[model samples]
Target: MAEDSGAEKTEQPTPKKLQDAAEKGQIARSKDLGTAFVLIGSAAALLVFGKMLAMAVLTIGQRMLRLDEKDIFETNSMFTAWGDAGGELIMPLIGIFSLILIAAFLGNTLLGGFNLSWQAAGPKASKMDPLKGLKRMFGLQALVELGKSFLKVAVVVGVAFFLLKLFFMDIMALSLMSEPNNIESALYFLGWLFLGLCASTSLIAIVDAPYQKWNHVRQLKMSLQEIKDEHKNSEGSPEIKARIRRTQMQMSMKRMMQQVPTADVIVTNPTHYAVALKYDQGKFRAPVVVAKGVDDIAMHIRKIANGHKIPVIESPALARSIYYTTKLDHPIPEQLFAAVAQVLAYVFQLRLYRKGKGSRPKNLAKELPIPDEFKH
Candidate 1:
């Protein structure tokens, strides 16, 4: 089992493994996916409400730049007016952010479903380990992440620069245009550039979400021995199961011993196997094995039968057939009926002779007429 600890994780995770992992907040979600969603969602929210926000900003700018010397010189008036300007902007900003927050939640849920991970939120001492933190943040793996961050930044920035360069003539024309026309042209180009950046960033999420899911599964993959151990845990541990089996067998043997006294006869291999049987003409149509065993147990059954004055007959083949094939308290198998009947009739003859009601019958059958199918 210890060796199996090093075994390859060659098996797919079982459903129980996935469920357990999910419960602990170990779900696959791409950071890029959420980032892209928030960016794109924020851009859309802005486009829809840009005019309202622009009006608030323009109002604040007008108040700040008013040509009234009295307003500029009055500190209390200036502060009060600025505060009112801020209030106008804050509400629209909050609305935009609330929309972005909803978008982020939806994106995360779409990727991995909802998982409230108490464990992820709970404080952990390992997080404070400077050595571990340093290794994670600035180690070899960190370089890979840092390189990716640089690449992402460069790609978005490069595309935006290229778009700006492509519209160089429009940018230059802005200087000669009216102020309102200049602002509109600038906004039109900037909006398209930002949307393009978000679209490109989203491509990263397309690959990352699936990769995260596959990696999460790889981390949870199980080895053969791990599967066995899990099965054992689900059913029961080996030692407890073995002890339970022994306890059950002991109880069964005790019950069988109790039934020995009720048996009319016990057939034996004489030394190795024993099968005690009982039959009542009105109670049962066929003989039932009341108790049975082999080796030491067989000898024990024989001793009990002897103590109860139950007859014991040595019939190795018949004893084996009944012991192996018949369940306690169940009728001997039908194929074994003739063999058992011969033993019972012989037992009955002995009883009659013992009671002094008749003379001894002929010698018992040399062997029970065992059917080939019933042979051990």
Candidate 2:
């Protein structure tokens, strides 16, 4: 979609879109904010480490000045003296530079967070297009950057002039101070100057940072069609989901029917409902419903039971009770235990009779003791 159509982008960018953009390294960041942070950090480092650094420099300079003419004249002595001076300054310089580097890292990552994407750094054919390059050079972003540069120059110069005027007397007094005092006072005054510049840059950063974030989000605003397409791709369309659900239900029903032959007995509501149950003395505390159904499904269960020679009992109330109160593959409710036990007992007797080991048992009682809660 053409991003030029502002009216079409009524919806905010989804989290997936934002994450995709971030992965591509298209994150919102303000260079001005980073610059401000670095400047302020540098200023702070200077304030904290300036005395130690100055002492190191002074020590090095004094050592060099005190070098004997013989040492200066000899190649080995000259090299040795220079090496010692360098060693004297290394620790203080490392301390100051390490702090500055840390500040720079924090400044760059503060708004957009740290992201390392090779795609952003890689070369692209699109980036080489002459027309696109020209367009970008003359774009609104270019104009904004140009205006920002001017504003920063104006603010820095203005602040510097103000600070100089405010500290005119103190600065002039530095001229009257002698040798080491003059250098120390000058370093102190320079620290204040750095702080003032940092403050001015921070003000510009404060304004620019919010604008950068808002502009980034505005660019990523999504159209309604785009959101719908994203949703369809991520979660699938409603018709496909419904079809998947239907297939799952069919598979589940087929699995339920397969357990029908394993049932000890089938209790039917004559025509409307059927429940198949299994019980084992050691395996279950009570009979469990292995399969159940209604109407046409009930007829299918009865047919399967008859083929397997599993006893089928016509008991409407008991069938309804087990069907309503028990889940497939789960034990019957405690309240239905006595009623299911009676049914199982009769099934056992019928099996023994068919084997010619005992006399045929009487049919199960019609009015089995079903709990009122499971009456339906």
Candidate 3:
């Protein structure tokens, strides 16, 4: 009921809302996740393929320095040397680039699955509005981003400081040692440095992913009115739906009453129930209940029957059974066949006698032989 303002966005996003947002390319994504992915991927690619690439570089250098006089003089040999150098670099470059591309793709998919949207790539005028940009730059998101940057810087700087302090004496001792020892020490330092960087970024990613998700959800929260409007759009508004139902019921009631005047007889519970029956030997094998009603509707049926001079039979059990068991335009069950047949026979006899063409029929069955089960 408190759906007054867009300000009260208290509802979590619905699936349809999320889907629509995705189509517009609105997704929760963290630059830190992508950065972490790229760093890890590049480090892995370089480590796995560094030896082969180093050998290729060494081979190129050797070829360049040791070229024969004939090779330098021939333009074709010169071109061949250049082609060999390019070929050597191509595989390593491709592998590294592919790793970066895969890292970016995976980072995005971690947040919102494999969603593709060109709309996100399109330019917008809002991006160029300096005031809007300034406002965003000073917004809570910007402050959060700034805090993340500071945290990253602090961790990296602190890790570097500690690593340097631990290695200060060993680094100085490197100068006094042989080349291989110094090289080994340097490699160990590089390994530790890479580990520290990876550790810091992994921590950042752990925090950033959830923050991005929460921020995205907060941005997309819906007001109560929005939820109601969405429901109305999906399933008609309640008021309109109720009105439609009422109109349909009235139309159905009118149609049922229209058939009452043509009924052969109106059976009743005398006060509580009524069932109008009609039979035609040519169009039907047995009697059909044209309509049925109770209470106010029963009284209305009696009034209409009286106006039309149609017979109204006060048989509580038959009326209750017909009202309960039979439907409009459908034949009564076989269980009621004998009972209905007797009523039809008496009506036929009474009609013929009224025209003075025959003698009055003997007393009709007082109870109409209604079944025990149908009696209630």
Top candidate, metric TM-score: 2
lDDT of 1 by residue, 147-195 (tens): 7688779878887788778888887887898745555566666656666
lDDT per residue (tens digit) for residues 225-246 in model 2: 8887899999999999999999
Model 1, which residues run further than 4 Å from truth?
1-23, 38-118, 128-135, 140-142, 163-194, 206-252, 280-285, 345-369
Off by over 4 Å in 2: 1-7, 68-87, 116-123, 172-175
Model 1 has an lDDT value of: 0.83
Count of clashing residue pairs in every prediction? 0, 0, 0
| Candidate maximizing lDDT | 2
lDDT of each: 0.83, 0.89, 0.82
Model 3 error, position 232 (Å): 7.2
Query: Candidate 3: worst 10 consecutive residues by lDDT?
Result: 179-188
Question: How many pairs of residues collide in model 1?
Answer: 0
Clashing pairs in 3: none
